[model samples]
Structure formats: structure tokens, C-alpha cells
Target chain A: MPTKKGTASGGTRRTPATGSRAANQRADAQRNRAKILAGTVTAISRNPDASVADIAAEAGVGRVTLYGHFQNRAELIEAALMDSLERGEDVLSEVPLDGEAAAAFQRLVASSWVLVDQSRALLAAAQKELPAARIRELHENAEARMRGLLLRGQREGAFRVDLPVSWLLTTTHVVMNGASEEVRIGRLDPEDAPRFIDAILLPAFTQKRDR
Target chain B: MPTKKGTASGGTRRTPATGSRAANQRADAQRNRAKILAGTVTAISRNPDASVADIAAEAGVGRVTLYGHFQNRAELIEAALMDSLERGEDVLSEVPLDGEAAAAFQRLVASSWVLVDQSRALLAAAQKELPAARIRELHENAEARMRGLLLRGQREGAFRVDLPVSWLLTTTHVVMNGASEEVRIGRLDPEDAPRFIDAILLPAFTQKRDR
Candidate 1:
């Protein structure tokens, strides 16, 4: 190997090969970082007070590797929280905001439920670990998206115009959160959550006479 | 004191007087206990990890007095949680369950919101400190009452019959919890919470054409 390296360094071809290996290493590092982030979400969600070693174990990475990726618990938690929110936003983005307001609202609710359910542990951990201000900031994007959709629904006459869009958005958010808890506790069937949510929420947003 | 004891030993009338004084003392103790319980709810709600001294201060009692009433933090938390549930039940009982299903449901929601709003901190604390089974036990009465109301509403054709009563009950519980959070976070106006709850929930439980 030493003799081959000495010869290879003298050739122009070695530089490109070394560069490609470095690129591959960087990609592997990025993939590992993402896996650690996902693992942190699950670990923290299951136990809000989980240790870094616990998270590393859940992530299937070495403790040293996890520490190398995240300098501290706070940094790792922040990353996990952001990761959850971003995934939730991705789910929301898949929903067509401009379609029939009621139908779109239902789609949004159903799709968002999947994200909400997956991130329950993360949400619980964040509430316990993060400050109110930070939690609010993390929630702002989801709130804005909801508010915009609600207002659009109201404007299109799919939702009640008399009620403030903020109220509608707040109600939907709360119901969804509550529903998730119900499902978690075995009070509501997880399979039926979307329908349960729509049955309860669709009426709230739609016109009184239409229901 | 020696003279009084000698005189009391000689007099039959002193026995009744002493008994009355003892009764008064017991009544005063009961009143103080109630105050402490109420105060603990407020203190714990404001700060989930509130200390015994902090709760005693909120209750306007001495730390020693608080300890005399509740031997430890766990006992005090149990009492606070029970007190909240009892108060909520009282509110539910006041709303006549036999009246028109929709009207009764609205009254139940309005009355329950007041209790729910007041106990947010206690609920949060309970979730963190108490076991899931204990939390379920504490919530049973409220759940039963809501289930009854939903069933009654569906029977009367006041609400959509297609949805299960359990689903309806779960939805109502979650929405109320969510609404409480919204109020807690200052996103929804506290003074308007009951009305807002009614506006959103009435439709969910009631038939669309009926509205």
C-alpha cells in the first residue's frame, strides 16, 4: 500500500480519486447526522429526560459519534425539535391549500395527524424541556400555515365567515392535539383518528346550516 | 388554669362548652384545609415544580401548617388533583343532563371550561408526576359525564348519530384541553373562551341542518 500510494501520488489520476472519496465520506457523515437527529426525536419523545447515551443507542450510533455530531444535549434537542417541525411542515406542504376549502381542510387535518402522531413524544419532550418562548417560535410556522388556510376557507365560504379565522385555527389545532392524546391513550382508535377528527372539526369550520 | 380546671371538674356545664369549642376548632381546620387545597392548585398550575413553601405561601398558610395538612408533596398533589376533578364534577352536575341534548351539552362545555382553565397547571403537573392509570382514574367521572351527554344527544337526534359516542367524547375532551392551552398561551382571549368553545363545539355535536 505504501509503494502504491507513492506511485499514485505522482499521477494526475490520484487527485480526482481522493476527492471522490472525500465527497463520499461527507455524504456518509450527512446521512449519519440525519439518522442521529431522527433517533433523538424518538428517544426524547419516549423519555423526556433521556440521556445522550440513550439517544445514541436509539439512533444506533456510537456515543462518541453522537457527541461528535452534537456538542451537547441542548443542541441535540434543538435539532430534534427543528427536525420534527420541518417534517410537519413538509406534510402540510403536500396538502393542496387552494382546493375546496372544506375538502382541503380535511386533507390538511388527516395529513397533519400523521405528523402529529409521529412526533407526539417529541412534542411532549419539547414542552417539558424548552421555554414557552422557544415552543411558541417553533409553533409559529405551523400556526401561520393554518391561519392562512383557515382564512382562505372562510373567504371561499367553505368555512364560517362570522367566526374569526384565528378561532377556527386555534380550535383545529387544539382538537388535533387532543385527538392525538386520545389515540395515544387507547381512548380513540388510531385507525379511525382522521375520521374522528374530521367528524368533530369539519363541523366547527363549516357553516352551521351546512353541517 | 388550675383554678379553671378545678372549677370545671366541679361543674357539669363546662363539658358542653368544651365540646362546642372542640367542634369549632374542627370546622376551622376543615376550612383551612380547603383553602390549602385551592391554593395548591393555583400554585402548582403557575409553577408545575412548585415547592411546599411556595404552595403554602400561595395558600396564605405557614409551611408548617401546610405540612400538617399534607404530609408531603405527593399527598398534596393527589389532593389537588382530586379537588379539581370534584369541582369539575360539581359543574357537570349543575348542568341538567336531561334537558334538550344540545343545550345540556353547551352548558356542560361552558361550565367545564371554567374548571379546565383553572386546572391547567394541575393537569400538566399530574401528567408529569402521576402514572397514566392514575390520570385515567381522575378523568373517569368527566369522561362518563361526557359520554352520557353524547349518547343522549345522539339518541335525541340532536347530534350526528353516525359517529360513536366514544369518539364524540374523546373529541370534546381533546378540544377542551386544547382550548385551555390556547387560553393558557394567550392565543385565545380568556374572557371569551366559553363563548368561543360554544361557537366551535356546538356545531360539532349538533346536526348541521338543525343549526
Candidate 2:
């Protein structure tokens, strides 16, 4: 079957040749957008107070192009934070949730370790740059997802029901935040961080079972 | 009887004394000590950069007297941190560990609320005024106690067994550190603070129950 040709003149219509070229341009633009965003995030992570000019310089994009992608500072920061969270969420989602509750809990703690370890600077910048209202909004979304998973585990009798799901989620953050600080200061060997996690988180989340 | 004669000299020790009496003198000195400490703590909380002279003025003591109590800025700040941690430990110790695990957990979380709350200013000063090595030393002591409680709870079959107790204990600080920033800016309600504690801590520590 022959494809319909573009309508001429009055309306803007693209021929198949033009459409294919447009798709390639769109893909190239998307790649550029990703690079600019990544560059901005890295700059801000390095310096919480980094300006748009600095970000543009790092990305090798003009100020106009940077603004074209992000309308303002808050918008740029928000996008960066969202991107980081999305990455963290992807990691957490992939963690195997099946097993004894204790085992599952360990996986959860370990996953947090990975997230915090990787995103320490970015997370710190988010904490510094975002307003509390925005931070709370972001936190609430994460908390909801975490609580749902934990509650399911609890309901399945793999996790404890006595403690509130919210608390457990907060506790996970606390462990990672504290451990990250230690790692940053060289007080903790990065490789040994998991042991620190095990010593405290394992005991807190695990149920007593005969060895 | 012989009481009047006893009161003449030796009995003066037990009696409530006034004016230039030794007991009155001791009481006045004790009050002065407390006033100075309270003043220093308040000033430091508001601005850790406050000088010893400023702290003395706030405490209603002479600069010389402030120096008499603390050798220098480092000593004063260290003492203040220690005092804060001591109060924190006292609060944790007061939680009834012997009660039902859930009830005990609730009490612990509630008690911890104030500790977490007070830590904002303390941590800010710590980040600025204290060395990382010094902070780690303090954290180690605090973690030791927290770890014991978590282990005890696990052994009692009250807590889950998967995550590390160390991770749970450290994460409590992260939640506080993260949440305190929100609370300070009024973006998060102070009353709702407990929900944060409940969300992460309870799940991390409690065992899966039938409920």
C-alpha cells in the first residue's frame, strides 16, 4: 500500500521524508536535553549554590539554551531532584521483595545504602536548595510508596505490624544519612559501610529466630 | 532539749540557713552556675558563632566567670554538646523497655522526638564548630546505647530481624536532620513530627505481627 502524500499549502503537513528527519531531530534534541540536565545536576551537587551560568558553562550550552530547557533555578533544581529520586526508585523497585521478612528488610536497608552512597552530594544539595514545603512534598511521595511495600510485607507476616510503616521508612533514611556522613568524612570505610548497616538495622528490623 | 545547743554550731549544717549563712552562700553559687549554663546554651543554640563574652552577657555572668567555667570556645561548645547528649541519653533511658514491645516502642519514639528536635541546632554547630573526628566519637557512644535497645527488642521477638540495628539507630538522626530543616521553616507541622518517627522507625524495628 502507498502512504498518503502530505497535503499542500493551507495546512502544515509533513511528507514521510520530512517526518523521518523530524523524528531524528527530536531524538537529537532529547539527547541534548539529557546532557544539559545531567551537567546542571552535577554542578549543583558540587556546589549547592551554583548559578545557571555555571551550569551552562559546565554543560557547554549557551544561557539561552539552558533557559530553554529549564525556566528558572527552582525548576532546574526540582527536575534534578526528581531525576535522582527516579533513579533511586528504580533501584529500590528492582530489589527482590520475596523471602523471610527479616531477609527482605536486609535487602531494603542494603538498597538504601546503595542509593545514599551514590547520591550523597545530590541528596545534600536537594536538602539545601529545596524549600521545606517542596521537600515535604517530595518526601511524602517517597514515603507513600515505601509504606505500601512495607505494609504489604507486614500483612504477609514477613514484617512486623507493631511498628508504624512511616517510622520504618524514616529509620531507613536516618541510617543512610548518618552512614553517608561517616563515609564522606572518612570515618567509615566505604566498603565496610554495609557492616555498619547490618550491626544496627538488622537487629532493629529482624525478629528473633533460633539460629 | 539539747537541740538548741546543737544548733549553736554543728546543727547549722542541717538547718536551712539564710543571709550570709554557708547554706545560702552555696545555694547562690549553684544558681549562678545554672544561670550561666542556661544562658550559654541558649545563645549557642541561636547562634553558635556567639562569643564567650556574648554568652556571659546572656548568662548574666562576668566574662571572667564564663572563662572560669570553660577554658575556650572549643571547650564550651564541647561541653554544650555533651550536655545535650546527656539529656538525650536520659530521655532514652527513661523509656520503659520492660513493657509490651509496641508500647515500649511508642514511648521510645516519643521520647526520641525531643532529642531529635534539639539536635538541629546542635548538629549545625557540630557541622561548623567541631571536627568530624570529634563528632564521630560522640556518635559512637550514642550508637552503642541505641544498638543495645534494638538488640534487646529483637531478642524479645518484638523487632524484625533483617536490617542492621546500627543502620536503624543512625537513620533516626537522618530523619531528624532532614525533618528538622522542614520543621524550622514551618513547612512541616511540629505536631506531625511524630508521624515521621513512626513511619520509618516502627517498621524497621517491629516484627511482623498477626495484626
Candidate 3:
């Protein structure tokens, strides 16, 4: 995460004052773009069909400034999705995954559930606007992180070896999203989600008695 | 599973020959309606957006005859879904549940998965034309059947009791639907699904070591 300014504008600067002004303008543009993306995430999370004007108002910027950063609604939603995933990656990468594989997996679930709950609506919005394959491509890093952990858990004998690791991974996600729906329909309490997730998953991944 | 003919036309009989002719006509109407419903299932399963003409051709009936049974597409899809669920109920009620819980549960999954795989697309089509609550209402028998098995399994200590039975049932569906997608993507073999489902669910429902 280093910021590298474009060199296209760098070559035209001459006086020190002009260069300093250009740097300040670049910083302003960068901040506006970040605000618009962040605002898009919040607006869409609250309402998937949120209008562009709502996003601009949420970001406290003009509609022109919003369009200046993103060419259209799809571009804005995609960038918002990317922003949310990057934030998720930052959080998921820091969870301590060093204990027993089961414990580590639950911890991962506990941390990731909140992120998934927040981003799932936005993800659905993105699906309506983008190709399904592109959506899957954007999700590669997060999927790999979770898939790697499931593989490790299975190999260490902490997870069931009778089922394929891919199946395990797929069901794990399904369980989380199921909880999201449960909460949506008022069948489950949101505050109790992490514990509910762990309760279902920890037992689910353990060895089968028949084996 | 007994057939109840309408009493509206029951009292309109006159002479013996006329009564016989009326009964034959009733039987013919019943047969044609059954064919249309069966044809709708096949047509929708093959293509959810299948038209009235497609369904009529599949059922080998004329459009007028098809309309004679169903007032419109929504009514037809609803009838088709009911037909499927009733067929499923017939098969499921015969699955022996007198054995150990885990074995019985697997037996249930193996039998129901085929019905689900065949009817899911048709269900999706029903969902589009029908209210969601109505759709859920239509699925009550299937859900109740599965829920009863899970409850018995948990009560007998053959299935994990750490999670709520409702959560267990919801995730059971998610896993089945997940497998469908996996098969659709060509990642898993279609013939291997039952074994795959049993492998996932048996391990998933076993008690955890910590508990």
C-alpha cells in the first residue's frame, strides 16, 4: 500500500509553487475518490438499490465529483466491493491462526462472519451488474485464504477427512450465509451469530464416529 | 393418496348410459390434466422459461386442452409444483426410519436428493410466479419430513445436539443446493452426488470431541 502518483502530470511541472500545488490537488483527488468509495459501501449496504445521488450525499461530495472518480454506477459499485474486500483482507490476515486447527477455524469464522454479513448485500448488487465469472475472480484471494485453512484443518486431523476439503469449504460458506438469511427473516439474533456459527461448524468439522 | 372426484357433477346423472358416459368424460379430463402437469414438470425442468406451447408439446396435448385444466401459467406452475411435492411425499413416506438415526438420515438424503435435483429448477420457476411465503407453504411437507428426522436423530444422540435442529435443517438444504451448483459447474460428477452428500452430512452431524 504505497501511493504512486501518475508520472503523466509530473513531467509538466516547472516552478516549485506549481509542483506543490499539483501535489496538493493530487491529494485532494485521492481523498475524494476514497470518500466516494467508502460512501458507496455504506449506502449500498443499507440499500442495494441506493441511487448515485444518495451515495454522493453520504460522501458529502457533489454528484460531479462522484462522477469524476467513477464513470458510472457499475464502476462505483465494483470499486466499493473491492474496497470492502480489501478491508476484509486486512482484518482476516491478522486473525491468530496458530492454535488447534478447529479453534483457529472458529476464530476465522467469528471474525469473517461480520465482514460477510456487511458485504453480502453489496456482493449481490455487484452480481446484478457484473458477470458471474468476474465476481468469482474478484473473490479469489478471500476464497483462497479460507480454502487454505480448511485444507490445513483436514490434513491435521482436526477436520473430517472423509469429505473433500472443497465440499467442506463450500458448506462452511453456505452456513454463514444461511445465518445471514436467518437473521434477515427474524429467526436468529444478529448478536448471537458468531457463537451460532461456531456451534454449527466446530461440531460439523470434527471426525465422524463411523470413521 | 386417495382420489376425490368433485361432487358438483355427482348428482347430475340421469340414465345408466348417460351416467357411464359422464364418468368416462371425468376420467378423460383427469387423465389429460395429469398429463399436462407431468409435461409441465418435464418442460420446466429442462427450461424454466418454457412457454405454454412448449409445455403443451411436451405433454402431447392441445393448447385448448392444456388451458381447460389450468387458467394460466402461474396456476399451471403451481399445479406442477404440487404434483412434484405429492410425488415426493409418496416416496419419502416409504423411507424406513426404524433404524439407527445416522443410517436412517443417510437413507432419507439419498432418496430425497434425486427428487430435489429434478424439481429445484421447477421450484425456481414457481418462485417467480408465486409469492415467497406461498412457495414456502408449498414446501411445508418436505421440510416437516426432514425436520422430523433430524429431531429424532438428535433426540436419540445419533446426531449433534449442539446446534438447533432448524439450523441443521437449513444447512442441510444449503449443502444439497451447493452440491447442485458444484455439479452444474462440472467440478463434481453427477453420479457421485449421493455418496458425496452422505459423506458431508454424516460427518457434519456427528458429535464434536470437545462436547
Candidate 4:
């Protein structure tokens, strides 16, 4: 016999007591998408130039299932990259940037270190595979956000305005990239790496104040 | 009939009485060696992970000839990496560091920009493939050299002593790596990247005279 109007075959399947089944389907789709992206991250971490088949195999899914989600290797790689970036943005949004620019800078560096250490391989692959134009776009957006903070500090007389905002943004990216490389290569312990970042970057970004 | 002292040929058989023939052979060998190195540079510049077969194909030389000269891929790659490092060491050696510390810092940045820009791909590959111990050995030597200059500057009271010598080395490496990436992706002109390096690095390494 058929099931009830919203219930499924399972005796305990929570169905649309009020369209909850539709919500459950949506959650399942989101979970599947997350799984595919996670697999892509794993595959590309192993080999930056990994092909779509490699990603599919890692996900334990067929080529058609992979293609149904991502059209090609570039798309899959782009999605993986953007997913990491989006996660970074989310993390940064939660970080408080109040008080002295130096304090804010340290917090930012620490948070970034955590994110970079977690996704080191995927980040390296993105750098390798992403096109120049795409990188410029992403970098510019990040710079703008960072510059806004630096500008605020400058207006508050907490940062030196003699240096160009762009230079600060560029330099921060440089240090962060280096720290990430150190983490990836095991040159710096993931925990100790943040201390290095704090030591080097805080001094570079901080304005001198009378002690 | 025997020609000269050793062969059954009628004419002089083109054997020089002087050392010209041996000198000519030496010159030819040098020319072939240079060509092979140039080919290796090109191959590594394009693909740091390129195989010995790939280098041979790019160099337009037979596999036998390639192996006859280098013996194996590791030897050839090491030679290539060493050649690049020697060029950098030469640049470091020639820069006049006796003047103002900041001026000397600028010179270091300028020189490194040129070397790093040319061999970014090779550097990336070396980092990926070479044993970490060897890389650390070379890095330590470079650091010792930089440390001497930094110590000299600090003694002269023209530089900050708050940052460790290792931090300075890390900064320089980060700046070089950042500039190399910018050059590789065509975001910054090769000529213009040195200026970017100078702008970011000189200030970090220098005592803020204005402040």
C-alpha cells in the first residue's frame, strides 16, 4: 500500500508534516555538494594537476555524477577554491577588528594561519591552476577589504599613512603566503607558524607608539 | 700508406701539429654543454616537474646524448638548480654593501628580483622535488651571508635590532617569492617588479629615517 500524504516508506521517516520532506531533500543535496567538494580538495591536494576523473574517483562517484555537479576540471577547481575563500570570509567576519590596528592585525593573522594550515594543499593548487585574470580579481577584492581596515587605522592615527595602502595589502599577502608555504613543507609547525606570523607581520604593520 | 704516426691514411688527416685541434674540440664541447643547459633552463622554466625525456625533446638532443653528458635526471636537475643559485650568489657578491644600510638593502632587493624572476618555476620545482635537508643547507648559507650584513648595519646603528636575523631572511624570501609570482603571472612587468620589491622591502629592512 502507498504511504501517507507526506510520509515515506520508513516507519520513522520525518516527512512533510509540513513540507519537511522537501527541506530534507534540500539538506541532502547540500550534503552531497559538500562531499564532492571535499573529495575534490583531497584529490587536488595529492596532485595539483589532478583531472576530473581523479576527483570523481576520490568522491567514490561515477563520472556522470561528478559532471552533473561540476562541468569540468576548471569548474571543479574553481568551486573548490571559492569554497575555501568563502570559508575564509566567513571566519574573518566573525573575527573582531576593534581597538588598535596592531591587535586587530594579530587576530587576523592568527585566524588566517588556522585557515591556511587547514587547506594548504587546496590553496596551493588554486594558485597553480587559477588564471591570471581570476587571481587579479580575487586579490583586488581582498585588498579592498584589507585596505578599508588599514585606512580606518590611518584615520585614527594608529597606522602610518606614509605607506601606500596597497603596499600594506601586498606585503600582508606576501607574509601570509610564505607562512602557508612553511606550514605545507613542515618547515614550521602548524602551531608555531602563527607565532612567526605574529612576530614578523605585527611589527611590519604596527605603528610605533611610545612605551 | 700510414698518415703521420698512427693512422693508415694518406694525407695529414687534419691532425694539427699544435694544440689547435684539442682546443677546437674543447670549444665545441663547451658550446654543446651551453646549449644543453639553455635547453634545461627552458624546460624547467615551463614545467618544473618535466622529466629527462621532456628536457631532451625540448633541447632537440638524443636521449643517449643527454644521458651521456648528465648521467641522470637528478644530476642534470641539480646542475641546473646550482647554476641558478650560483648566478644569485654572484649577484649577492657584487652588490656594494659598504654604504648606507638602506641603500645596500635596496641593492639586495634589486639584484634578487632579477634572479628570482628568471627561475621562479625552477625554484618551485626544487622546493617540491629536492630533499628538504639540501634546501635548508643552501638556505642557511644564504641566511648567514644576509645576517652578516644585517649585523653590520645594526652595529653601525642604522637598522633595527628588535627583529631577529632569521626574520629578516624570511622577509627577504617572502618578498622575492611574491615578486616572482607577480612576474610569472604577467600581473607585473619584469622590469617593474624590482620597483615593487624595493618599495616593500627597503622600508622593512631599513631604519625609518623620517620617524
Candidate 5:
């Protein structure tokens, strides 16, 4: 109890009302942000041109409150899109990596495919709102994670080394995004997405080539 | 000369002044439409949000004249995109398909890549303007040509048959589209795009896989 009462952390501090009330407000703000993000995804899913007012209504929050969390439509859309990706990152972080490179790639893609499908509308909204450079900047962390796995696969001689790793990464995105368009347009069944991705990507990555 | 006079053909009609005037006007209209479509492609290439006024100015046509040809902005963009695609179809139609399937795929991609690169901005414009189904409808002829080639590849056992031909077609699109993005962002060199596309897609199409 004595060691926990140090000046560093707010919960352990002496000012009861000040620290606790501030903490409570911060928690409330986080909860509202989460709600707004979820609502934005749903709103955009229903209508890609959903307004900020529409999102606020869907979130059951006032316009002022939504603005407090996000300054403008572009900011709000970017935040919502990033929030979904970060949530996917949590699942990606937990995927077991100690295995055959090909098997591990499959496991990672399986976890990711559903997230990609879920966030597609928001992703489209983000693309409309953000610059291409900004979008690429946001994808850096996700790209790095995949790059590491791909590098390991290449190192193990499990994946083709003739092509650049960057191009391979691009193909993965193309497949996932193309699959989204396929599912969106009813060209591809949603349930087949994960298997379809693995089927195309795994062989493509592991192929032996003369040219 | 008397035998050349016919009711069906315009040039052979007896009303000389009226017929020639209408014929000249039609040629002028065709030239204007061609100029406008080419200008639209260039305008969208410079700015995806190029306005009708901007496009008209680029084509050196009066706004009223531009409107006379295209009903609206959507119609203008669709026509421009379709025009470029039809131009590519000319090159695609000439690709000698009488050879080995893999080699023909390469030749077709080589012919198609630059056209795609050139028209990508207009495609983005079209995506923003038109519904997905409408865009697909416009792509029917292009898709048919590709389908025919890919079907030949699968039938000849030169490309993989395990995956559905439709999914294989999707993979080709994914690869080409992905390469464009790569080139757009300066991630892949423009000079290398054709080869890069060939490398990834040929293997993706031809790879024999366990899974």
C-alpha cells in the first residue's frame, strides 16, 4: 500500500476527487471514441457517402461530442479506419509465428481476411478522404509485420526469391482488396474469401519460376 | 456513277448539298468527341477531380458544345474510360494467340500494361462516377478477350487449372492493378512494371500447388 501511493501514477496519488474524476472522464472519452468508430463503420458500410451528422446520429452522440473526438469528416473517417486496423493488429499480434513459413502465412491471412472484409467500406471511405501517401504511411506497421514473415519465408527457401519482397507484399494486398471487390459485387462468395486468398497467395509465393 | 446511287448509303444519296453538309457535320462531331475524350483522360490524369469546365477548357471546346456530346459528367468520364479501353482493345485484338499460351499471355500483358497505366486515372474517375455493375458492364468486351485467352491457357495445361478460371482472371486483374499502384507510389520503377507484372502473374497462373 505504501509503495503504491507514490507520486507517479494518478490512481496511486493523494488527490482523490481530482485524480479519480479525471480518470473517469478519460475512460468515458475512450468509450465514446470506440462507440463512434464502430458507428462510423456501420454507417459507412450502409452508405459510403455517410455524413458526419449521420455518423453522430448512428453513434447516439451529439455533433459537438463527435467533433470533440474528431475535428472533421476526413479526420473522423481516418480515425475510424485506423481504429479498425489497430483492432485487427491485436489479432495479428497473437497469431503464432513459430511454424513452417507457408503454414504461418496461411494462419496470418485467415485471421486477416475477415478483418479486411469487415473494414472494406471504411477502407474505401478512407481512400476517398486521405491522400495516397497518408494511406501508405498508416499501413507501415501492418506492412512491416507481413514483411517480416515474408522475409523469413524467403530466407527458409520456402518462398520464391526471384521477385522483390515489396512486390510480393503488393500482390497480397491486391488479392485481398480484389477479393473485397469480388465479394462486394457478388462475384465472390464472402465465405470463400479466406480459402480463395490462401489458394492464390500460397502458391504464388511458393512458386518455382524460370522467367 | 448511276449504279452507285443507293437509298441505304449516305454518300451515294441524290440530295448532294444536304447529304454532304450532314456528313461533314458528323465528321466534325466525331472529331470533337475524340478530342474531348482524349482531353478528359489527360485532365483526370492531372487531377482526379477535374470538373466539366476544366475538361471542356482542356479540349478547347465550348461548355455548351461539350454538353452537346456528353449528357453529364458521368457520361463524359464513362465515355473517356471506354474510349481508352477500346483503344487498348485494338492492340489486344492484334496479339497473336496462335502460339504457346504463356508466351501469348506475356505479349498480351506487354501490350495491355501501358494502356492500363495511361488510363488508370480515368478508371479512378470512372469508379467514382459510375456504379460497380455499370463499370463491369462497360468492361464486358475486355473481360471476354481475357477470358478467352485464360481459358486457352487452362485448357492447354500451360496454366493452373485447380482454381476456377474466373478466380484466375481475378488474379490477373489484381496483379495488373497492384502494379499500377506500385508504380504510382514510386515503389516500382515504371520501366520494370511490365516485367514485374509478367513475373508475378505468370507464376501465379502457372504454379502447380499442393494446396
Candidate 6:
């Protein structure tokens, strides 16, 4: 059969070209959003009262471009917070959840301190500026994962089942966050965080098996 | 003997009168200072940004009187912080520290939570508006007492001795403060604070004795 005429061939080629161009644009937008988010974390960490204009400048993006990616200041902060939490979750997901529950819990605590120490300033600013409900929303997934691990521990008799998992998870968050604050203020040595966490948190979760 | 009786009797009465008057004045001054400090705590708790005038109004004292007690706003805030810490220390002192380490620790945590919960706003404001050093200074006494108890527990084999007692005490403070923040933000139930503290903290300090 004879090939289609010039106009039909041109239509097929042009369609693929247009689709690739659109995909490239979408990827570029995502990169810019990531850059803006990273810049926001830096700016807010340096100065909790940093303005949108300051953050945009820090990102090396124009105000209009920043606004295009994030509608307003609150939205930008929320995005930055979500980005930080996602990073923490990425770190947390690496710890094996199926092993000896107490050992897994220790690994979780150690990995968590790495993220907590890194995000101290951002966490402080968010806790100060955001509402409790919004902060809790960002933490919901982490809490659920932690609760699941604790429940597994309890079922295996490695952890106490007397206390609610919710309280245990909340206590874990509170202690980790508090330790981060201590490190920030120079009250606790950063290197000692993991040991402190293991020593303090393990006993709280683990039950006396012989008993 | 009767010749000098009149003059000597008058002198004796005048000396006692003067001494009593000075003692009365000093006591009154202390009472007024206490009132102003209490008022400052209330005002700052109600609004972290409260002004000197607002505190004076809260105390039902004139600005002049308030200033007479505390020279300036920073001084007033410092005084208020010290006063709050003193109140907490007073409560802490009531917990018998010489008893079984675990039971005493629980009592300490319980009594401390009462003060922590009551002074949440004041503590938050102090942490925010003051330098870390100043806040740490106010906490020095409490830290000392906590360390003492931890040492006693370690010696008695009631608590883990492998970890530094200082770190353990710091973790205790961190967890308590975090729980207070949770209660303040309505994330954790206030009534559950004692149980949460026991469940989370007791194990952190208690040594794993043979059950």
C-alpha cells in the first residue's frame, strides 16, 4: 500500500513532538518546585520570620514564578513541611519492621534522630507558626507506621500491651522532638542522641519477657 | 534610781517600735513582690505578648508600683520565670525523694506535671522570648534534683547505670515538657498525662530486675 500523503504523516509526527514537549515542561515544573521547597527550608531555618519575597530570592526564582508554584505564604510553608515529613518518612521506611521488635525499634529511633537533628529549625518554626491540627495531619502517617510496629512488638510479647499504642507513639514523638530541641540549644551532645534514645525509649516499649 | 527612769523607759519603747516597723515594712514589700510575680505569670500566660501595663492591671497594681517591684520588662519577665520555677520546685520538693526510686520518680513526675501543665504558656513564652542560656539557668535547680534522684536510682540498681544520669535526667525533662506541650495543644488528654508519664518514663529509668 502507498504511504499516507504529507499532511497525514506530518499530523502523526507533530502529535508525538507535542506530547514530549508537554512532558518535559511538566518535569521542569517539578524540579523548580523542589528547588523552591529546599530554599524555603533553608530560609525559614535561618530566620523563622522570613518573608515570601525573601524565600523566593533565596530560591533564585522570581516572585511570580514562586507564586506560580505555591499560591501563597501558608501554602508554601505547608508544602515545605510536607516535603520535610516525606524526607523523614523515607528515612524511617528503611528500618526493618519485621525483625526482633525491640531491635527494630532501636533502629527506628536511631534513624529518626538523624532526621530530627537535620530538621530541628524547620520543625521549631512549623510548630510555632502552624496550628496543632495541621501539624498533627502531617504527622499522621508516621504515627500510624509507628503504631503498627509497636502493635507488632506487643503481639510478639516484646513490648508492653498495657498502654495504648497511641500514647507510646506520641511519647516517642515528644521525646524525639524534645531531644532535638536540647541539641539545638546545646544541652545535649548530638553524638549521644542515639544512645540516649535507645536507653530511654527501649525500656518504655519492651516488656520483661521472663516476667 | 528614779532620777533617770523617765528618759530610759521612753528610749526602750522607741527602739522596739522602730524595729517592729522595719520588719513590718520588709514583710509587706515581699508580699507585694509575690503578688506582682504571680500577676505577671497570669498575664503572660493569657498573652505571651502582654505588656508591663497589662501585667500591672492583672495584678491590680499601679504601673509605678509594678516598676517599683520590677525595674523593666525584661527584669519583670525574668522575675516571673524565676517565680514560676520556684513554684515548680516547691511542688517537686514535696515529693519524697528518699523512698523507693521508682515510686519517688513517679511522684516527682506527677507533681512536676501539675506545675508544667499549669505553667505551659509561661514556659512557652519564656522559651521563645528569652535566650536559651537564661531558660537553662532557671532549670538548673530542677536539673540538679533530677540528677540526684537518677544517681540514687542507679546506685540502688533501680535504674540503668550504663547510661549517663545526666542524659537520663535531660530525657526526663524533655519528655515532660513535650507532654505538657501536647496537653496545651489539646493533642493529648490532660488526665492521661500521669499515666503517659509513668508508662513512658518509668521504664526509661528503671533497671531490669528479675521479676
DockQ of all candidate complexes: 0.56, 0.20, 0.36, 0.22, 0.51, 0.49
Question: Which regions of candidate 2 are displaced past 4 Å?
Answer: A1-29, A139-142, A156-158, A208-211, B1-172, B175-211
DockQ of 4: 0.22
**Interface RMSD score of each model:** 1.7, 5.4, 2.5, 3.4, 1.6, 1.7
TM-score for chain B in model 3: 0.84
Q: Give lDDT tens digits, candidate 4, residues B1-211.
A: 1112222322344556435555555555555566677788899888767888999888777888788789877777677778778777877888887888767777766776777777788777666556645766765645676777778877787766655665667778887787677667665667767776666555566655555
Off by over 4 Å in 6: A1-33, A44-57, A61-76, A91-96, A186-191, A209-211, B1-40, B43-78, B93-95, B185-192, B209-211
In model 4, chain B matches the true chain B with a TM-score of 0.75
lDDT measured at residue B193 in model 3 versus the true structure, 0 to 100: 82
Give per-residue CA lDDT, model 5, range B69-177, as digits (tens): 9989999998887887778888788888778989988887887788878877888788778876798888788788788899999999998876778888888887997
Scored against the true structure, residue B67 in model 3 reaches a CA lDDT of 90
Q: Candidate 1, residues A70-155: lDDT per residue as tens digits?
A: 99887788788898888788778877877687877787788888988888777767665666579778879878877888888888
Model 1, docking class = medium
Which candidate gets the maximum DockQ versus the true structure? 1
Candidate 5 residue pairs in clash (backbone atoms < 3 Å):
none
- Assess every candidate by TM-score: 0.77, 0.53, 0.71, 0.65, 0.83, 0.72
Better of 1 and 6 by DockQ: 1
Give iRMSD, candidate 6: 1.7
> DockQ for model 6?
0.49
Write the residue-wise lDDT of candidate 3 on B25-57 in tens digits. 888798789889988988987887899999999
Q: What stretches of model 3 exceed 4 Å from their correct place?
A: A1-79, A124-132, A208-210, B1-83, B123-134, B208-210
